[model samples]
Target: MSILVIGATGTIGSLITQRLADAGAEVKALVRQAGKREFPAIVTEVVADLTDVPSMRVALSSVRTLFLLNAVTPDEVTQALITLNLAREAGIERIVYLSVIHADRFTNVPHFTGKHTVERMIQSLEMPATILRPAYFMQNDRMVQQTIQDYSMYPMPIGSAGVSMIDARDIADVAVAELLRRDKASSALEPLTLELVGPQPLTGASAANIWSAALGREITYGGDDVAAFEGQLASYGPTWLAYDMRLMMTGIQRFGMQSTEGTVEKLQTLIGHPLRTYEDFVREAVAEG
Candidate 1:
């Protein structure tokens, strides 16, 4: 069976593609730009844009499993609707979707709402689907690499609240396993929601300490000013996008984004190993740079 991975060049998508390829599955990497082909030699690269339904259909024609991942955009809902329709029409048996944590509760945030909409659409389809809701990524720390290198600080609005931040690589691993095992005989496998998380929940101060130890430098927690953080993000990102991220952070601090019990155990059973901790992610990320 062939597996098609959308956004294959992205952070989490790339890891999923690699894992599937390593497992001896016939993997196809979908990319909008021809020049962005970066997967290993075993992966077949297909060029298709998410907005073009016909092209996507052509890409999905011979695929049995699909990994759906998309960045937030104004046309997210339309794109997801068309893509899911095309996949079902093309006879795809299973889909593994990467979604944000607390998507259903955070309706005011456009991006999270978009993800929730897609999740509902996936449920409506007849194909077997696994919806993975992951909390804030520990990989987000990479965005502050420059700050960590220069000022030795990481800024976030999470305050002292502990978040069950996950590593993107771990998320990819679980997605790959689900796609590969879609046809396996299991009574408990259909229409499942997996709450993916890291080995432990950590506060901003704890995260800073982990990074500081990993990087062998002093790292400090900058601030808990959600409005100021939103203002700074707005200068670089779209207005709605900035607002959504700020609102999500505020919700995290207030409601606590830590996953419920058994998250790690369930994920480990799927991936066949233990999830990576914040400290482990820090060391690997630093080594890669």
Candidate 2:
């Protein structure tokens, strides 16, 4: 029973591949540019593009489980549908998708809507699937590294809203568990969705405090001007991405990004240990900087 991980060179996907490989499963990585990827020697690397169904078919051959994640792009929905169909046709039995929390509720945001569309497609499939909907990742902090460095501040227009952030490592751990477990009962094999989140929820101000502690400086929350922040993002990022971010931020501010339940319990049960805290992630990010 081999597991094939799509987008295996990416942050979360790479970690999932490593975890599955370490667990003694036959791991295969499907990467767009095969030669550029530096995976563990124990794992097999296959070159394939999700948009190219023939290539994806070749990549899916002989794989029993697939861990699906894709780069954020305009064509994500089409690519996902193509890959999901190909995987099903190739006899892949289980699919574990990494999706964003509140996908069903945030149809206005392109990224969340894209993920939600894929989740619906997966649910409609005959294959057993698990959709892991993790909340805003603490890893998102990396995006504001320069702001934190320059002004000792982190800015999010989401005001006092607290979000239940999860570390990408925990997401990968649970995904690998589902991929490597061969004895998954048929009842358990039915399509399911799990909300993955950190141990606790923290407000934007609290997150700034955490950054302040980690960086040894007073980092503060800056503004709640969503329009201004959106304009700022547009000045730096791609126009489509800026629009998407603006829409996403609007949803976060209005509905909040926090999960109502603790996804850490499921993560801990899968890994046989406690999930890493937001503080731990901050420390690691700072150390890496």
Candidate 3:
């Protein structure tokens, strides 16, 4: 049976969809509009909206596995709950949910709290699922890549305590593995949660240093000024989303986004390789620029 992939046009979701297709899995990409983006020829595109019940039911029908990833929006929780309910109604058993690391701890952050709420609902409903709580994504740096290149500064306000950032590629691989594991199982597998993190935590200064080395020029750490970051973000995006991101940064500054004990070894064992490093990501970004 096919696997339904929500948020398939997004950075991580696109990677997951392509990887699943490459692995010979039947993939149904749930896109809001058909032909909005291109996927492998083998992928079956399902035009559906998460908030639209009728469309979602068609998307969930006959899918053996579901990769549940939604963008951070005002009604993220609603969308997730609605989709999960539909999946359950459709008798779709296997699921892979992409939640953030420290989702429970960052209760003040709307997106984090929303994901935590979804996680709770998934567990309470006894859904056979894999909850992947990934740390800060290294790909997030792509947003500030131009700032680093043009201004010689790293501007994320990710603070001194540091964040264990994971690569989107690693996240996609792991999600694909978990989806297949449960989808092809002889029976319903037990629900599991995995903390996906990088090889090590990276402070703002350390990140700047990495970029400096990559660019062969001195780059400075733009200090933790989340207000400035929010102001800049608000210039281009919604004010509410900018403030929401500011709150998330504040939470990260207060309580570092580090991994739990043995999380690195556990993830390495699962993927059979060391997690990709921030330095490598920086170098590649620089090279591509």
TM-score of each: 0.93, 0.93, 0.98
Off by over 4 Å in 3: none
CA lDDT scores, all candidates in order: 0.83, 0.81, 0.92
Give a tens-digit lDDT track for model 3, residues 16-116. Answer: 99999998999999999899999999999999999999999888889899999989999999999999999999998899999999999999999999999
* Candidate 2: tens digits of C-alpha lDDT, residues 1-289: 5788888998899998888778777889987775777888889999989988789888888887888897889999998889988887887778888888999999899989999989888776556888888888778878887788798878876566667788888888778777666324443366778888888777778888898999988998876777877788889788898888888878877788766554566667877878778899889888898
Evaluated with lDDT, which candidate comes out highest?
A: 3
lDDT of 1 by residue, 1-289 (tens): 5889987998999998898888888899999988585788899999998889789979999887788988778888788778888888887767888888888987877888899988988877545788889988888878877777688887876777688889898888888888888734343257878888888888878888887998898899877889988998899889888888898888787766778888789889888888888888888878898
Residue 260, candidate 3: C-alpha displacement in angstroms: 1.8
Which residue pairs overlap in candidate 1's backbone? Answer: none
Specify the poorest-scoring 10-residue window by lDDT in model 2: 179-188
